[model samples]
Target: MVRTIRHRTMTTNSSKTPSSHATRQQNSNKLSRTKKACFGLMTTVLGLVAIELTLALLGVGRSNADGDPMMGFSKQVPLLERYVDEDGKAWMRTAENKLVWFNDQRFPLTKPANTQRIFCLGGSTTFGRPYDDNTSFAGWLREWLPHVDASSRYEVFNAGGVSYASYRVAAVMEELANHEPDLFIVYTGQNEFLERRTYADFFEQTKAQLWLTGLVSQTRTYAAIDSILRKNAPQESDADSIVLAAEVDERLNHTVGPSDYVRDDEWSDKVREHFKFNIRRMIHIARSANAKILFVVPASNEKDCSPFKPDSEDGSFETGQRSFDAGDFASARAAFQLAIDRDICPLRAPSNFAQFIRDLPESDDVRVLDFESELRNVCIDEHGHDILGEEYFLDHVHPTIDAHRQLSRWLISEMREAGWMAADSIALNELSAETVEGVDQSILGRIDRTAQGIAMRNLAKVMHWAGRFEVAAPRARDAIELLDGDAESQFILADCLRWTGQIDEAVVEFEKGVSAYPTYFRGVQRYGLLLLELGDNDAAREMFSIATLGWPETDPRHWAARFQLSIAHLGACDFESAHRELQECREHTPGDMDVVFAIAEASVGIGEPEKAIELYEQVLDEFPNDVDTHLNLAHTLLSTKQTDRAAGHFATALSLAPDNERAQAGMMVIDQLKQSAE
Candidate 1:
């Protein structure tokens, strides 16, 4: 029995041996595959990293932009720059201070103990246009802070920039947070339309794509690859919709204000949305830095300031004017409000600004001051009319000196109410008119009649630019009464007359305004233009020469003056000088078709028929139906003995403008040339 049991045990052991060997072999194969997969992945990753590093080192994907990069902007921009001085101390200042955007400000690298650093932010109203910071609310706050608070040494920074929109203010606020700001007093709204940026396909991006893009954007490798692809791909060069210029390009200010703007309700709605975004962004930035934020509800001179750009038809603007004329103040007010609400170019703070401020969900760190209503109440008390104007405002939105004082006092009161300032000191509040009026307060001196006159003329010029000739004429007259010898008012009034078809009256005014400005002046420029129109080429040449001489090449006015001078040269048939001036202007504004056309005309006059023909071809390609271009090209071709080509252009010009005198002349010349050939 023991021998039989041993044989069975030996057979069972032999059967299990083969099964164990098969299982072991299977497990070994699985482990080997895993090792191979891991090795392949590691090699691929190494190769990718090597390629990425190589592209990054080549500097393939880099772009230079100015101002603060925000909200889907790929371009890198910085507002504030940190610089170390010779004394081994770091200071912070606005980059490119000479741009005249931001008021001059200096802050140390480190925040001081027992120091309350206040930053006042906003648009041109905050920057104090027609005057400067001293007369602005920011300036008043700096001076008045000492009376209101004593515990902390107050350092009020005028962070207000000229033509700065709410977006720019928010961008600046972001930078101020890094400087250890105790408080940020934001006073924006008037300049929302001054600068704009469109985020190309920002909202259209899928969440996954956004996430992936955000991740890759952080890497130099991705930027390089994107740059390379963009360079290689056939695409529109200026297709991207981001506004990258460091300074605000106020559209109305740059272009013929009347021609550039039209009622685009969609764009207006977008602007309102952006205004809200900027306010929320500022709040977020303040909270992130643990800084206190206060928003000032901005006011507008609705009842006083006329609609800058009125509709062509007699519409709400006319109704408002009639209402005001009829002494129906209530109806006038309503109509005026409607006009501003429907305004195509809203340089003044829109009604939505006040609503936006009041709508912000107030938190412990956030504060809102309804200064708009406060200003109106003050207007009611002082002027017996609730409508604010020259009584408390310099222009549409810029507050007068006394209004700035009122703003400062109100801000102090708000500070005390918010418990930001410990004491409600009566010292600043009790300031009698004698103390302020008696002393020469700011560097520019107390708001004198000269300053007021300058501001008035400025207002008139803006009105004139906007094609509001009727209102601008009266304002210019008022400015002249105050300024006496001021040429700006004179020229603006002259322009009003000229535009109104009173040629003789305009000529008289233009003559009076000539040679008024010592340096560059709008009046002098306008006078030169009038001279050009009147065929006084020598006088026009002299006027433009003076205008361009003083300003640096960096100033747009310098190039503009040069352009005018070139036209003046053309008027005198001085082809060489005209060509030189146009060439210089071309250097400034390369794509200006007006300059190109003028250059072509000058080339023709200078006996370069072939060059003129080439330039005319370029212009005709872009503006095929342009009668002037066709006629000019025809004339140029005729000079080059290209009768067939000349006849073709002349025929086209006649078709486009049958009554065009120059086109008629060109056609007659072409017919004569063909007949001579026959």
Candidate 2:
């Protein structure tokens, strides 16, 4: 149906074309306006979308704000709390929740006022694990300094952490400065270049990559993309983690091939620079806090250093290389080679590093403790290997508690020489007792020394053990005067006074003992026990609490103090407090029969027969031979109206220990009660 579309073609003449151009211009203006409007609308829509997406990605939306996704993820990861081991010792965890310091207290951050506080900063070596806290170098220093100067009242605080590098140590120093410490002692360097990648590397690998990307993402789509990528990325299997760790250890040991650039002079220079930088930062922080600083180049076993072969013409590198052949020679060789290349030769490196450190301007105020020299002399054998037979070290690097004691003695000597301590203090004399004991008695006897104090103190100890208070008192007093206010001497003196009806004087002496060395919990606990004996239950409980809280949780004395506090609570008729103390004591020493019995007694006092019965059963099952347990169980059963059971337990107790007065009394009562019932 082609109705032929007739098209009218307009032909413009040259004069008429101008008028046609004007009409076309109007149409073009209209098109331009429409395009501008479209562009404006698109730009506005995109801007709003961007704002919304940014809010979403940042988790700023109301729904996301209400629900913490990051917190949820964190919850899925286990949080490691401080835990006590089977041996009633505590283990420390890192900020990352990784187990670090085993069977030791986490380093404290605070220092007391008006006291000269020395903060020992280092790795596990300084932390002094597998040793009693009192035997740690810090503890040793505290114990020995008094020998150098009996009146020296310096408080040494060990702030060491496991796997801590120099940078971490510096951070710890900064954190600790808030506690107003007077001196900062640094014992680090081995871990500086030995631990897998430095803090700088960790920051680069994690913060720069994941943290920055997370910060910059705008849209949920981009955020999801990043998350998915992170999730899908290959997870490190346990075996892989272990292998990687081994590889890291190899790298730290300097096992890299010569072809690798790590062994170059530049690498050494960089390591030196890293150490210097950290040291400088540490100095700055200490200076800012008006604290004195000392740098200790860590000492290592002879095996840690290149073997000292006088005749074997071996370069340091060659000597290290030889160590590689001792074990799986290939692995050992790799380890030795890497160690040399990285300057990880523990013995040699400390000396070299010390020299470098000494040259620094900051070192003007910083004393070098010469730990390397001391350790080398003590730990090295004739064959240029570590003497592991002594049990003074746990491994090639870490010192045992006994070793820490030795180091502490050396440190005290150095400190005395440096004029950091007093010369005439009682502590110095007491600490020197051991050294003097090693001295020839003939040489000591040549001096016109009065034997009054020494003889009296010894006699008092013997008499006290024999329960002869009348004889011990005068001797203890003379000894206290001779010992010149030594805490142990004062404690003995107080015990004597307490036994001789001089209660007021005894309390004063006990207080003096505690005042002399607040860190000495034995004295404090004794004072508390004395208070309990004096019928000051409230005061005794307070003292016991203070003593227990003063030391680390793993300290045996800390548990003992808690047990004492429970006894105080019992004396004061505070059953709830007694129960709480018993619970804490039980937690620390689960197998302790005394603690179990105490808990049962506390439960009975609190009218919890069921709990008491359970605790009694536990004591009987585990400590069937314990007379006290049997006696307590009898009383608990009698209270619960189980007379027959009480009588049977009493009979067993009599069989185990026939002279047990409490058990006999309990049996008599049970028999009488049963007779009355019959």
Candidate 3:
């Protein structure tokens, strides 16, 4: 209804003040200034981003030496083309670096029209350590594939690297996609912990952060920044430096020691997530490239090898050790599993990682090869234990040559189930002796004594790490004999000699070892330590100095070099030099009780009893059970006429070790002093 409305004007007298109008004007000006500042800042940021992107695309501001966006990467990649060698055997460079070859197998430039090419990817286990390529499962599979179907052609490529984890494998898969692989077999999970990333570097990355990282990882600027960052990173210890060569490639070696075992739930969560992501990405890539994929859940030696880094808070490791000592293998296996799950630094993948792998095939349209379970079952039948040990595994992760053969048998069945092989052509029973011989001739049977010895030496190192020195010594001796003066074998033999109490023989071997590998610092350092043990202080000092001279200052072993030098100086009675070296060691490793004790020993040698006492007391606070430290402290206290304190320490030492002669003598002296005073 269009009704007439009446408007009432009610204007207040207070509504139109000059002061209020001026305040309103001031507020409007402030808002305008804020908006202008915001706009200017946004414009500046956008301009900078545009400039950076432009420069990046133009290759103007490269961060890496190769004009690559990522730092520390070399642009000089090796030609990875297949070529027939003089022996008519096919070979190719597996990596861009000339260091690695495809062992004795080769492929053509293009896949044959009727042939199915399968590429296997993983770490040393897949690479077949302690065994040549012919003995690897992939190598065996290559030979076995032809026997499955005489009319159909099949080819298998062992694309495994020494320490390649999944991330590295993903890159490899991408490269091989161009080579026309019809199928891909991935057996990994153990080597994720092999990379030297910190917990924070892993878990703290958000999805957005990961997206940014993915974008940045493609740029030379990021590469340049990474190189700069690593250049300024802290040095490694002497122990790591001395033992680093035991690995196949130092470039792939872990740069830092694994973190001390802790719950580390955050790190575990991130690693699990990262592993899943990498696997999914790999699967997606393979599928996109029109290749069928098979994932093998890896097996490890749980009952044999101890946890790489045991947790301090968890008692499972101790329980497992006790069970192992008691010879209760079944119980030991369960306890060991607990330790492996809790371990912060597990070089071998725990059962949980395998569980993740087992769960993968359910959600995705891929083939699942449960090699882990089959391996365990075979091990149980052969060894009467659910978990495998040295009989099957070369170490904690690597399988024996025989184990690889067994694995190849199991994988063949899986392939058949996945319909990769012909059902009617040949059964497992039909694999003829002639086919076996040919397989042996082409791939499996060609590992020479020299190669075997090298593999043995690598294997002996794992034994040495596990404290089976007696077992390792014989293998080291065999390596030396077989290799006939190979520098690595000689050095290993010298170490074995020392461990086995052949001191004079070890000294001779050490001298020969250092001479054999003049540039290798480990032999030189070991030679010096051997000489020091034999009381040849002057020779030891010279040897230690030589060991320190040419090594990179940034190497962790630089501090270790200084530590050995200090010991040499102390042995030579060069108190001042020893003190200086100890000071340097302290700066590098402040928490090292060995360095602290060494400093105290030098103080005592120089007749600074008060300083010696102070240092000893500091050490005792941290390690009260140290018998030698207790004896030293007691003597110092007695020298200063602190009889009661000295007596207490003497008694404590005797309680710790009843056969301590020095402690016994000190106690007798204390009794005499008390009797005389009374």
Scored by lDDT, the top model is: 1
The per-residue C-alpha lDDT of model 2 at residue 93 equals 29
List candidate 2 segments past 4 Å from native: 1-99, 102-114, 129-134, 146-152, 195-268, 304-351, 358-365, 375-394, 400-402, 423-678
RMSD to the true structure for each prediction, in A, is 12.0, 23.2, 11.7
Per-residue lDDT of candidate 1, residues 1-678 (tens digit): 887898888788877765677889988999999999999999988887887778667755423121223343333356567888899999876677533677666677787888888889988777777577777888888767665566668888888888888877787777678789889998988888765566555555676875675555656666666678868976443566464465676676568674577777766776777687678878877877888999999987776666777655536756877887787767877787777777777777777777889778876788888887898788778766565665676567777777777888788888877778766444554766764543326523656778778877887887777776765776798789988866678888988999878889988887777645445366678778878988999999988998887578998888888999999999999999999989888888888888989999999889898888888888877878888888888877877778888889889988988888888888787677668878
lDDT of 2 at 252: 23
Top candidate when judged by TM-score against the true structure: 3
- Give the TM-scores of the predictions, in the order they appear: 0.61, 0.36, 0.62
Q: Show where candidate 1 strays beyond 4 Å.
A: 1-77, 82-90, 199-243, 312-314, 431-462, 469-484, 497-511, 514-678
| Candidate 1 whole-model C-alpha lDDT, 0 to 1 | 0.76
lDDT of 2: 0.61
Cα lDDT tens digits, model 3, 1-678, are 222222121233235444677889988999999999999999987876786787678765544221111111113343256667777766554543533633444577667788888888877778887666778898788777777777778878887777766656665676677677788889989876654333334345677986676666555556656668768866553222212222234322333334333456766676666677778877876776788888898988676566656777787866877887787877888888887787666778878888888888632337778887888788778867665666777667888777787788788887777776766767655777887777767764577877888878877775665444554665677677777766766776677788779887888888888877876787788778878888898898888888888576678776787788889899889988898889878887899999999999888878888998999999999999999999999998998889999999999999999998998998999999999999
User: What is the C-alpha local distance difference test score of each model?
Assistant: 0.76, 0.61, 0.73
- lDDT: the better of candidates 1 and 2: 1
